[model samples]
Target: MIEQKVIINLTDENSNNLGTLTVSSIDCKNCNESRVRISNSLELINIPVVDSADNLTPIQYCPDIGANFANLMFLEETEYQILFESSDACASYDVLYSLTKLNENYFKQFRFSLGDNKTYKIAGTLNFRSYVGKSFLDIRKNKINSIKIPIEVRSKKMDYFNQYSSMIADLSHHALSLIFEVNSPLYQEFELDSKEKKTYYEDFMFLEYLFRNENLPSIFEYLSKNIHSQLKNRTEQVPLSLASNFNQNSLKNIVSKPNNLYKYDADFEIVHKLKGHIPQMIEQTKHDDTIDIPENRFVKYFFESIRDLIEKLLLSSDEGYIKDKLLFFSNEIEYYLSSNFFKQISPMDYVPFNSQILQKKEGYREIFKYFLMMEFSFRLSWDEINNQFKGFEKKLSELYEYWCYFRLLKVLNDLSITKVDFDDVFKVKKDNWSVSIKKGENSVKKFKFILYDNEIEVELFYNLRFSKNSKYESYSLAFKPDYTLLVKIGEHINYIHFDAKYRSELEIADYYNVFGKSDKKLNEEIDKRDSLEEKESIFKDGDIYKMHTYKDSILKTEGAYVLYPGNKTEQFFESDMIIPSVGAFSLTPGNDGVDENNLENFIREVLKTLLFKHGLINLNWKSLDK
Candidate 1:
């Protein structure tokens, strides 16, 4: 082991005169443990560790020290380091030198052997304070063999710059107010008025047009259309046998003698009338290929006359208006072949043959239409109307749309408006195709359909087993549908499909044929693409049919209806089915054309069918009448 005998001989060379150090150690310490015993004491003196082959042991760095540490001492083994440190110490004397404590209780009593004659020379200018937990100490000679053992210090405080920067920011705030030179990189993220921002699909009409002409980009494109067609087709195919009831025209006339036909409520009028006069028109059993319903006299006649027209209105036209409105929504333009659509489907005419006051009120139509005409006149930039008429136009628009649902109610009234004679309006017999299951009453895993908010979420981490082709990307985002269905008629579970669409349009090209030539993404949207069969086949197959079926069912279903803030109802081709104006539902039930009671009944039936326990009974659900 290398022994260090350090002696501090003070001669008072400079100021800040502190203390001295002396060493008396040749003690036979253990060879293995990292320790050294020393016998000498000094104030304002430091003994530090340095790096060198012969100077220190243990090559790893240790950082645990502070500046201004007192009673400083370094135990040198030259092999192992067992540095035991205590500070704020009292002192004792060596054989000749008097010692005073410096830091902790870290002083020495072991003698220097020279009992009375000791001379140490240390300069007063060097104020040597100690530190700990450092890798190495630097020794620099200062003139006469006196050296400075540099101590590596741990920082005492952080936040030296923050205190100064705050003052500058305060001054800037007072001087510039809101008109400061915004020079920060974060300034590019300026806030925008979210209400004024354009919608993601502001040009949704263009997408609608493109979708009608071009084939879709996925396997589920036609599913919705096919589903709608199937449903409508099945509805049209229903047998039209009249119910068992007496004719009500004469009864209506008899009741009208008091000018109170509008409020007429005859639950048993037909039965009362037929007791003696029309006995043959009482009971007649009818049979179709699949059904058996009794024919009522009055109900039969009432429906028989308009059954064809109602069915034509219901089943014939592909497009339809909400009761009386001019708003239209359809898959194909051919379905839009009715009246002038939104422009002509005035909302003032359908005042219920009952609100005779509103019906008899003739100029009401002009008043109602004048404001809408003027507003639209100004909006579409047709004939320039004076801005002074703005207030009148707004008021008329309000009364016409509020007090009278001209376009809406009329379209609903105009719906293949058939009156089915029920045994009881509230109680229809259970001839349902299948049992209705409420949520949790049935198994979620066994559902025929599933809808999720994130199609990508399901495909990733969830590990859904579906392959991607040229037509649709594996991680493509699907529609955020309002509802999901799980129908299981027959063993058609193999018809598993989904409908995923974007509100935005993507002009997808034939990746199959054109991809072979260049293998790049095509930019433009083509109207007709007979040019790409194999690529388009993905979207044209039975899979797509299944998906579209589910999609269309959800789209047209009562709960999953589409809505907008500015939509309007219109008569496109037929009756009330086309009445999905901006914020209301349409009434177009299956088999029997929709009527007053049918709306409620259809809702209850759909709620049951949808398996949702929460039905739409209490909801002040706005109807096409709105």
Candidate 2:
């Protein structure tokens, strides 16, 4: 066997060099077992087995060094790659790598042998140093004798962190854009005052014309038709003090100074009697931009509401670069709120003389519009935000699921067998992200499709409960599937289960043998192994296994299937009288609708079987019995 030596270059999260690790193969007699020992005191701190099964096998590209097999070592004089085995076979644990004490007495053994004095170098660089679990060996062989080898080591936890952080950034920017843009009616109304103030004379003339319109109340008729007409015919521009010509003292004496003079004692008695007979009325006025108006409160409230929401989202998230990005945006929001630009605007206040006038009031209507836009930004409703930030993360997944549900509904609607009646509950809260179906009310959480003409009911539930206990047994366990497409005809209920596996991954093999399998024969051997293994590893082991358990445990369930994101149309797996399928379809988001060919074809096939069973179609089904 070729003699091999490994050098692990440790780096920080930023890829800055910390130190290098070097371990030499130990002298062992076993031809199959390879042993190596680390002689440095500042080398590896610890080797943690992150997989729950504790089988730290090297991945396809990595060598079978002593790191994987307890009784073997790869002491070959060639380049190597280090990577961990597939995670599906192991019980899941935290995928974190912790740095351990790099002391002496670190001896390792592998089920291989090495020839003497051959200097084979296998180097790798692992990024991120939060040492908690075992690190895998990733390496490959190449003819180019490069001095340094570079490999990116990413933990699953970090992957999730990156994905989740991206989602938060996307939503934060969206919310901020909505808040800053002045296109909403509320902002437009606020701008109207500035425009009128810039050209008051022109605006007053326009207002005169507007007030004279037949749509206005009778109170403004004289101001429109009589006074406006008189002003318009004068050709000359009116003086700025035009209002000074009118005598206001007479009106004040009649309205504000009623008791200024009493001509006689009888006059005083009569005035007192008239005052006592007049009714006292208080006008309750509402306005936007006023200190006391609730609409004016929206300014500070808008800033405060979103600030609190983003802060909550930030606090709930794991502290990372993503959190820092959110913090930066939050600070930006604060700056915008406290800036002189926002402060210069005065609050709007007005009393509507007519009850319907507020709706016509541009400034007032704008305030309401602003309220709605802000509410939408925070996904806030009357009582709760309903975890709006988190909900946005699920938006893509939920959209796909809902599309699938509706697609199925359309199929049933098109069916000639039964007259379809479909009803769904879609509700949005007053100002929040508390948009959801009213649960516990006639299957509100699920899409209800009832065919009254044919006595068939099909209920498509979205993450709804199937049973509180196992359907196969009486165990008390809640079984909530992502979607339970239940079809009921007469007295029988048939269930076809589906789950949306958004992140199921297929394995990629290193056929080029960049990782030490340079020999053509050896490369072909590994390829053969991979091809055979593909049968058992078609889908993610955990996801496919969960589907099987769901199918077997659910009573009288016809078939259980998984809807994953991939290009393949479908893949079926048969197991012990139970046939569960794992299928793929392109359920991505775009301006256009979903690419429905793959999913639609599958649904059509299933419908054909159902229709035949119900005697709605003329096809024979004796083959189905087999």
Candidate 3:
């Protein structure tokens, strides 16, 4: 005797069941057998039989009765499988399944049909290498019942949710502010023409931020209440008999003839026959109070444009929270546009700088301010902005690289570093205010300070490249570190390079394990490498040896280090020498925020060594050349 039941199992990389799977039986009026649907066209056949309790046994026993949401914990870049089985043999069945990322634009679908088989298996690799968030798997049976399983994807490399997300958000926010601080030259070139302005990612981000702002609702309400109006005069034709007032120009239309006038008593006939002609119509001027001023027209145009933008974002966004917010803003804009106040205003072309009401009125003033900001947002085309940082949002490595740039800036600023020259740090290009830093360019920031009566000139470079064809040529091959700092005291100059590694210490440890060694042992071995080929191989693999490559290949390099988001900081030094060294520094974002003390202390130590301990340079520094 076979028991009527069905079972589905979800397993991890090792083919171990994550949890128990259960299914409930639905009654079929025409059939006595119980059936369960698994996935696309896949159904379980159950044969009913009566037997003694002692002799009866189930094919697969499940403690749970009905299907329930299962929690599946997934590691990024791992493989997993789903297995389906029934108590009895089934002729044919189809199954439909899909994995969808919650609130993100990612999904994968799978379909399978089995014939004359009681079991079926589906296998796939789940690669959330660059993302960590909530997702779900949906399995449908017979196209009637759906079983949804929730999945939590996590990164084995770093603290992706709290640390990575927070750091990226902070970096993106700062980058956005920098972009806003600059007025694009394109705006001046285009002459503020709407047709010429193109929307970019920054513009969308700004609009999203603007719509979510708490002050926006109050601004709209205030503008709606205190709308400005102007008196408009319009000319219309009216009958001559109905004209209340007549001027000399209007009176000329009536001919002066004796027969033209007819005098009669209250009910008597006319005394004289008709005249030659009489004017049938006259032009009259009418005055009306209209909210058709430039300010009002601009307000209408702004709302309409914003509403359209909201709709566009809505179509592109899949996140529930973001969609909800967009919908709310869209509805609010729609309501305002359809309101009596806005309906009274007529649509007109956006006339730049023609609104006194916007300039003087309190509510309109705020709208005008944002309108100007919006104009700046529109100046940069999407292609240009995208080219600046390709895949910035999707790739965590790219995001981490940019974040390190800004984070280092904050650290330097916190140390009271004063600018000696501002030309390369920040500048106005054409009409746009922008940071001077660009990938593959010599973006430098120079600072000077007096230490022990010696003037130290510090130059920090971002994404500085060294090549055979460049001024600072590499001895072996071209290599570009994320940041390079040069310190000049008198005639001697020292260079230190830093590379931002997105991999955490744990990942490095795992990589070393593949070679049957621990990270500490590998580091020791790396320091002992004598052959150039070994060093070149490690550098090609992009391990800690890359730091070695920087220190060895770049001329005058004192120290080369790795800046990673990890908990441990490892520093190594050459025998009897501190200046020539290689190490990794922990510079990760924490719950409270990034703790720069580790990196900051190391930098101060390096500066101390450079300034005070460099061959009596500090002792006679007062007499050294500037």
Instruction: Say which candidate scores most in lDDT.
Output: 3
* Model 2 deviation from native, Cα RMSD in Å: 19.9
Model 3: number of backbone collisions: 10
Q: Tell me which residue pairs clash in candidate 3.
A: 39-94, 39-95, 39-96, 40-94, 40-95, 40-96, 41-93, 41-94, 42-93, 42-94
Instruction: Please give, for residues 1-626, the per-residue lDDT of candidate 1 as tens digits.
Output: 43333343322234222233333233322223233233322222122332211112212112232221212233221111111111212323121111121222123222232222233222111111111111212111222222232222111111112311222222222211111124322123333222321221111211222222222212113222221111111111111124343245434433444332223234555434533222211222333341111111211222222223233333422221111111212322223222122222223322232333223333322222222222211111101111112210111111111111212222223232232111111121123211111112121222111211111000100012222342212233333332232233222211112222111111222323443544333322232332232222112222222333333432232222221111121112112332211112222111122332433343333323332222312332333122
Which should have the higher lDDT, number 1 or number 2?
Answer: 2
Better of 1 and 3 by lDDT: 3
Top-TM-score candidate index: 3
Query: Candidate 3 on 44-122: residue-level lDDT in tens?
Result: 4462322211101212122231122112334443333333443334312222244332222232223553324544434
Output the TM-score of candidate 2. Answer: 0.38
Q: RMSDs, each prediction?
A: 40.1, 19.9, 14.9
Model 2, 358-421: lDDT tens digits are 2444444433444444333332221111222221112234333444454444444454344333
C-alpha TM-score for every candidate: 0.14, 0.38, 0.53
